[model samples]
Target: MLLTLLWTLQGWVYLAVVFDLYSRRVVGWHMDRKMETSLISRALMMAINLRKPPPGLMHHSDRGSQYASNQYQAMLKQHDLVCSMSRKGNCWDNSSTERFFSSLKREWLTGNLYSTRESAIADVRAYIAYYNARRLHTTLGDMTPIEFEKIA
Candidate 1:
């Protein structure tokens, strides 16, 4: 998600997020002042550590430079994951991530002001926790992501 907290003391912060489609949960995320390969790599690694998904688990993302970087691609290969990229200039292919960002900005971040990077990070962390554990997801039979996981 391209963070719009440009008013922060440190400048704009970019968020790299990995969302699990099964339960509509944000499995991993990272925020940094710059949008770079390292930011995306860290987010991917965090997701791997949390889920340890099977070797053939399909990892889908947009064809962004960060996701296409050699460093990020190497990490995906090392983890034995399969890559699925949305077509260029096609936003519909990745609507789930888009919806997540929309909700994040509208439901959680609208009108919020962050004075520093840490403040933004703290709010994002809190929102992710709420989203995964308590927020009801209509797609998962109206259960929270954690609740759906328990049944699965």
Candidate 2:
């Protein structure tokens, strides 16, 4: 399952887990509040537009109504992406996504609070950019997500 983490302030910022199946790189992401269809929809659209993952990619997420919603399922169907839903009350199946959230909270969220959502949004946006571009991942051989993707 993906974590739709929001930076609480004037406008919320979201960090999507456009997590890859091979390198586990985050290919697409967006920052937004509302947590409505648009937030995740935008993330998925960006990931598809940019990565063009050769179709039939598997997209997994928890049973949040957002992920299981009709609109989400329809979009996946249109994209020919496989939708894998975690079982009820079970988070183990989505440990990777969960771990990402844990790291985010431990490293960032716990450090500060934003008076406005916009401030939070900005901070989270920078964090995600660094994460995908510069942060090294031991799992990916000390390569950033973008780096690993390039090497692959």
Candidate 3:
């Protein structure tokens, strides 16, 4: 899924994230000035490299053009992932990722005004670290994502 951050001077920084639904963990993420297919492809590559998931794993996302692009679909096919897209105009199908982005903005980026894209990126990186290692989720039995994964 994708989210955008607006820094005071740098304007918008787009983030593409690949989230693990079961553990509510953000497995991969990339940020750039453009919201092109490459943005999401890089994030997907990071997840593929880190997890090395087996074939037949389901990959879900919105029906965005970037996700539907040939390059992105080719990557999914290469990884042997089964792609699932949400219904038209429906966001609930990818609600978990949507909620994660909501938390990121509401809890971490809401009050801050970053002067540079670098600063926004740094702050977002820090938030991801804290989110995975420290923030408790009620859905995960009040444990952090790392903790939930440890015993899962």
lDDT winner, 2 or 3: 3
Candidate 3 ranges beyond 4 A from true positions:
none
In order, candidate lDDTs are 0.83, 0.73, 0.89
lDDT of 2: 0.73
Model 2 Cα lDDT, one tens digit per residue, 33-115:
66666667777888888778667778887787778789988988999999888889986888776766676677867868788
Listed in order, each prediction's TM-score against the native is 0.94, 0.85, 0.96
Q: Candidate 1 has what TM-score?
A: 0.94
lDDT (10s digit) by residue, model 1, range 41-150: 88888999999988888899888888888988898999999988888888887788778888888999889889898898888899989989999988899999999999
Candidate 1 Cα deviation (angstroms), residue 78: 0.2
Q: How does candidate 3 fare on TM-score?
A: 0.96
Give the higher-lDDT candidate: 1 or 2: 1
Write down the worst ten-residue block by lDDT for model 1.
1-10
For model 2, the stretches where C-alpha displacement exceeds 4 angstroms are 5-15
The RMSD of every model to the true structure, in order and in angstroms, is: 1.8, 2.2, 1.0
- Write one digit per residue (lDDT tens) for candidate 3, span 3-101: 554555778889889999999999999999888999999999988997899999999988889999999999999999999999998878988888888
Q: What is the lDDT of residue 52 in candidate 3?
A: 98
lDDT of 1: 0.83
Better model by TM-score, 2 or 3? 3
